[model samples]
Target: MAASRTIEDIINSDTDNEGDFEGFSSESDISVCSDLSDNDSESESEVDQPRNDEWTKRFTPITVNDFTCESGTKLPDSFDVNSASPLDYFWLLFSMELFVEIARNTNRYAKWRMDQTGTVDPYWTETTPNEIRAFIGMEIIMGINQLPDTMMYWSKNPLIGNAGIQDIMTANRYQKVRQYFHVSDREKEPARGHRDYDRLYKVRPILDHVTVSFLLNYNVGRELAVDEAMIRYSGKLSFRQYMPAKPIKRGIKVWMACDSNSSYLSRFQVYLGRSAVGVEHGLGFNVVSGLTNNIHGTYRHVYFDNFFTSIPLLEHLYENGLYGCGTVRVNRRGFPTELKKPKEIKNRGESMVMQKGDSNLIATVWKDKRLVHHLSTLNQPDDIQPAQRRVGPTVLQLQQPASVKSYNKYMGGVDQHDQLRMNYTVGRNSKKWWRYLFWFLVNCSIVNAFIMYKETSKRPRNKKRYTHIDFRIELAQGLISGYTGRKRKASEIDCIPLVDSQNVSGHINGKLSGPKGRCRYHLKTLGVRRETVYGCTVCRVHLCRDGCHARFHNL
Candidate 1:
């Protein structure tokens, strides 16, 4: 009786549909669309359809809801594997296997590049795992703080007030990493004649690995969103997009799906111009379906913008047991003609709601400064909620439709992801376009790792939490201390050996005789020194030639 009473109470409750029809069937519903049709003989009048077909023709409107999905084995859940060690966040997200693969690819390409250019350095004879880790650490350091105008400046000067990156690493080491950073091994696995057909061949190895790790390591919440992200790049690439609305108007465009609350990028696809040809449905529909393919039948509510929202897309989602909510453009197919019509300003907060027959599809239009339209499969026509609105100088309670409120709440997930990515972005301007994607993946990994730490940490309220800035600093220090393995800097290799002069026997034995003074022999090998008491220029200190002088001038 309680269930019946609950249903009866919902039925008897006041709704936004103007008046409740006691005799109307719940199935007799109509979706707001540009195109109007019926399985029965109910032809909509011309007024109900869009004024023009040009806009509607742009999108191949899917009219049927015949979508079906095959069930697959569920993924293993991720646990708090990084609780014991903070560095575990880095290791967990970027596994050692993955890092080794990256290192091999990068080393292979660097050797090949060096061979081609005929430029060789002994330090770069063979790239080691420790140096690779130090390379990554330097990158994290750059992200956590401002970078100098030139790479050499980071080592030459005390840019950080008391210390520089040179304190831990020589500038040349950092420069080598930046110069020869490669993501794919072009020699072992030729990108040409591949199934991907050189679309993302440049960085496909890193991309595939990182994407798999990201999806497998994190579990998404009930709400998700699909959106586009622009990687700031001004290059002569065929796939470059020019979106004026985006902060980086000219750059590469990526289609991404992320968790609604945490903004964790679950899956992503890079737009490859005319090469993007396999999608049977429109781009928007295909993107939504492909991104959510893994989570189909999970009933997660996916939200997106008007660019990706349509009746067919929402219908496809509903059919697959996933819910969708988004802002609907008037020109999109299946948009209600009533919501698109021009209305005079009657009041500050006037609104209207419409629903499809026999279906739960609902559309709401609210007017504040202008008409706002939304479409959803998970909301009711009469669900109204109040929110705080600022009027003049005072805040006041205002009624908002549930669909509009829900869309506003969930639609910014991708935007939030973009903001966090750009805040401490590891990406730097590069000649290769794929570098943009590589850094984008790294940024995503770092962001997802931070999210994981927040979710798993059980610290008390007063305990300090690691912010994004703190995360980068900690990760940088951790990578340096844990992985670099080098206990001292490369500069120590320049330390001078004694010439064994008769008068400087005490200094030769590594002991100071009197007040500290610079040794002429040490200055040539070590560049500059001010510690030990050695013979000054007045005493004519012997400067070594073979080990220190020869190497210095040659270098």
Candidate 2:
């Protein structure tokens, strides 16, 4: 017999296009065609033209084999079934127990779903019950073995395919599992007085909600990512009046502090409202406090952004045995000095030092006994130099292009003329540079926080501070939220893409080419340094090392 063709082969065959049976027509068919053609040219045209109308076809004969078993095969013996492993027995017992629990307490919501779908009875009998039991059993096994859900299927029988195992571990399946695990009202309560029963059965709404949701989602003990998203919802009810009433729908603002690697360090959710009445109650602090209160070890550093970097807040963190580093708003009082207007502090040909005191700016130190509390250490002891006390603010300013250029020149580069031009441009455009500088500082702080968190711990925290403006900009740029801008200095013009170079390099010549001026790391003019690599993908411009990639990228 000829070899049977597979499905793929049959689909690939093109018998219609081959037009192979040229002389295989019957005499009657030929006569009928000739008669139709002779009758009318129009009829022949209509017959020859493709049918534009829809048509349907049906198949009747079976062309494929439908064998179930081979004649030589035999069923396994009872002894083989009895030889199952201990793990198998444990899984079966665990699953069955869970199934029983789910059957007992499946939620009213589950019932509602069943009712809406109009397949509750069939689902319950055919799949739901078994699935619930299986999931619970699997969960217990996972917990006892200290394994992640990702690895739970490893111990399953070979018959359970990857997809099948995944289906058994889904959120819905776990919900069913939860129903099984809940105790009956009668069991929860006792045949006793109301007060006594109430005392014994006190409900913990917050803890219960978190626990149940976490378990159902199979994230019981897992550390969540820092960049959790939030969407806004509103209601006209008096209770929700404080929320954004105009837009009606808004996005939640989240302030998150993460390490350098973008790992979640800490986060909080702040609702959108004109007043802090129903919001800004330190949701982040509460969560972090809870987490830290229950844990034993001390955190070395706690990162934060400008909004949360209040003196009192920092002091509180310090009291709790944690160090903090964050951007400080320029308006924030108590710095050693403040410059009212932007002026060159240092000049080669200047007569007298143009101090802020001599200029319009005035510096004052308020000794409010109520507010003069230290955050980490007692102001680094008075012996520390004044410059050191101003390091944070200086670092903040140096994050700008002009300051960067000055530093580069002070460091002495061989190409002095080009550096001078870059410096002059940055100095002349100080106002524009300052605007970018503010954003740059913000970005650098976030990036620094991300790096710190990633390098520090396994369970990073998140933030809760969102502005609609930030979100819209991020969306337009296709960037993740909380990104800061570039970290490069102004003197590093060589890092910028040379548009002229792009025009010169037409198409590829098949052979590898050297790095062109357009390349991100083109360091010839800028003088390649370790800091040039600290740029965000979007900016693709060399940045000062002080800037954070996460902040820059997002911005």
Candidate 3:
């Protein structure tokens, strides 16, 4: 006979000596079921089992259920509806959808949302409602704010969700939204009225895109802002599709002006063309005209670039009680007659020339029986003392080495031929040259503007000294270093040679070296060649040499 054993003892013995039983030769005696039939057998098994008294005492049953405190409170069955406003729900949906999309693409938001909510709901399921969805979409696209829950909820009531929500939430969504908002109305208006609508409507989209584009310039603390925007049309059409035709290709360019400190886009314009100057197209004129009709009152300064800074345009702006500050083509109508001719100034050193004070360059076009030229009606009667001098430098600065390096891929270096050859090529194809040059200038202007904006956006308490020189140096460094893998070295060549009252000086350094030495570099580098060559007083093309026969000039 054998000792009686309990179930616990049997289990413990089996576990403790599992290897010992491997050699149990008597199968009949080791019948597990047969051995457990009697109370005595079970008791004997319990007596023989191994035990850890401390472990056995410490092991207590753990019953886990929905946790409840002594106060009998428990987690609510649903989300905190009272805590979340309509806006909150809207924003949540919007953000969640965005998160879902990002999650699907990169799997980042998926894990985060799962960890946060312990459930996964498809974005489509959450963003199906109009009022809830629109707010959410806007929140995700724009941002959310803190407010009374009631107000936020009410405001989100009108929101809508659609397949386009994804597109609407993109940084570029404003333009598309604006386009969607206006395109149908524009198509319905009379041709003339539609033209006007097109112009005024351009403002918002431009502002939206520009605000986002120049975010970095404003140091907005996010990369979400857009700085440069372009729109190109594509559809089934021949190469010669005309305006207003179906499948017509169209493009728009926008430039923004912002509040100095706030970095908010305060003003902007949409130019319809391949280049800024293309704003001269009928569509551009209509847009400008429309914008003019819409402005409620006067403006202190109408800042723009050379493309839109025409005499007629300035005069029109002035009629609206706005002053203007923008780059103007040297040949633009209304340039002071004292300015040098484009040909004379081409590839030549800078020099001031005197002309009849009353003579102004004006735009002229001939009709069947009459000749017409664009003129500035705002020019003060020759009698009026000239208004306060234009505040900034009149001359366009050259690109810095850094800017050149960064932008060289687009600028294409200078032609190897001499300045005369270069001028001839540009002059022969003035339209093409002007178009390319204007775009290049636009890019440079944007960079300059961004630098100015960023410098101005610093915390007032922790501001740093910033200057045009600093910007130039930084840009040059970026361009040179980025493009050629070389940097602008410190040297006398980097310095602007000074001149006397006559604007003449001895050649301090025999030949410019580094980037300045390269002819192509001159065309691309900022504030270097132009500042040097055009500003030089000693150069033969600039000030009259002692023995030269050219007409002497004065301010």
Candidate 4:
């Protein structure tokens, strides 16, 4: 008998050993029986070995009495969107209390800006809920109708431009809001000496609130998956990630758990370097364990890529009453030594299975174009399904194990979320690193809102639903129209009413007497002057009282 070799050895080794069948052999074929102790009969030196082998000592799989999918066998294709509208979804996530807090923060920051810039009036007036709502709407609209150049381009470009946007909320106002956007007061933050203080500080309360809101509002499917997303950013940051494979290779990495069926994001954790708080095990285990903490003691099944899968991690998930399946790297320790034995796979669809201890934990090594290994607690080795494979531009049907098929079907949930998010991404180039996170939350909120809208809409399936752009436009219009102040118009003139001056002095003896001035709106130059007794504070023009004041705002 020969010693069993690890999967890594077989994959990396350049052995020319060939199969006996037509040029192939079934040496790798191992039965996936309920027990492994019986297979040790093939190893004649069993008596000479120690009493406790690595396999017997490790992998104490707990026998689960019952297994069931929470949402039934067939997952829902779409949710029931009842009478809810986008605004309802928005309000649910960002509640009225949140709006009031945002208003307070905006006003505080506005006062700070006024004091710093020595401006007579603050850049933004005390913002009301309506105005803040409008601001967010404008942001969503801007995402759909993005301009190439700086935000100033929105005012200058005629075809896709709207001067009203700049008038209602000036570029200066936008800058001020972004500059002093605060979810938590600076004075109340935890001490910097804390382990997670950096990320806690970087991710302000608004983001944390929204993320929590998202998770709490939605129910995840029985099959959930964990993966990472790169929130695109080019700024210098402490925890920036650079994955060459990612399209946005340089940015912040966020580990997320989402529903495999609906692709709804359930929970997330941002990677904040080695000092990130509550980190346990490796990054992989920490991410999986943290994200799935809420789902523990349930029958939920988790799927992840090879990057995060390990024997210990799977065993721990089993201990927590959750089942998991993923591709495992051969080099990972605790994998059954007998299963890793070097043997030839005779054909493309050929497979070998091995189980360890008394638990249902099993590993199936399937031979295809390449050797593929899958580990699962829920799927059995004999559980095979039909899957299509591409062979030299021809599609062929092949038998695949249930674990492999399940992993493939559910593993892309995070990627699906990423795809939907990128379709109308609200992200833009920014100097501030926090802006990236802000836009990520904004995008996430909108996507979640969209999902809720779809799920709750009572409209027929064939009926045309609101597109992303349409939804954003509606929100923008709602916010803009809700503004309470007198709207500025092109027909208005910036001239002080002569009657106002006379009224102020109580000298209105049916005579107007004051310095000569002209309507600023009528003339481009200040050289022209007309007889006037009243003045406007902002425009600094002299004109009749009621007519000009009302005309300037209402026209």
Against the hidden reference, what TM-scores do the models get? 0.74, 0.27, 0.26, 0.71
Worst 10 residues of 3 by lDDT: 420-429
Error of 3 at 493 (Å): 70
lDDT of 4 by residue, 1-555 (tens): 011333234323422222121311223223434455776753644433322223442333334334342331121244334544566566556565766676676677667666777875634556676666666666666677677754753454567556666556656766655566554555445676776565556446566577667654676777898999998887788789888987999999999888888788878888887764664557798889888866555657899988898887887888776889999888777776545643766577767765554455777777778878878888765677897879799998788778888898888888988988887767457787876787787777777767766665665434365676666565457556655233543224233234443333222212122345665433433345445455454444454454544444433
Clashes of 3: 41
C-alpha lDDT (0 to 100) for residue 40 of candidate 4 = 75
lDDT score, candidate 1, position 497: 41
Estimate, for each residue in 298-382, the C-alpha lDDT of model 1 and write its tens digit: 5568899888888888878777667889888888877777668646425656677766533546667787667888888777667
Model 3 lDDT per residue over 1-555, tens place: 012233224223422121332211112222232577798978765554323121111122211112111110112245354442222322211223332332232233333445567876443222222322232233222212223331232232335322222222322332222222211122223454454454333123222333223322222111011122222223321221234432224333443343322233323444443444544533423444443332212232233334455656644544543333333455654455434242333321222222112221122111111211222222221211211223266643221111111122211111111111111111011122122222222233333343333433332322276443333333323322222111332232334443333332343312232222222223343233332222232332322123121223321
lDDT tens per residue, model 2, 379-453 = 111111211114345432111112112222221211222222122111011222121222222222222222222
Regions of model 3 farther than 4 Å from truth: 1-228, 232-263, 267-299, 330-555
Compute the lDDT of residue 188 as modeled in candidate 2. Answer: 41
Of 3 and 4, the candidate ahead on TM-score is 4
lDDT per model, in order?
0.65, 0.28, 0.29, 0.64
Candidate 1 vs. true structure, TM-score:
0.74
Residue 381, candidate 2: alpha-carbon lDDT: 17
Each prediction's total of clashing residue pairs, residues at least 3 apart in sequence or on different chains, is 17, 43, 41, 13
Query: Can you give the lDDT of residue 113 in candidate 1?
Result: 81
Off by over 4 Å in 4: 1-82, 112-124, 163-167, 194-198, 276-280, 337-342, 459-465, 476-481, 484-487, 490-555
Better of 1 and 4 by TM-score: 1
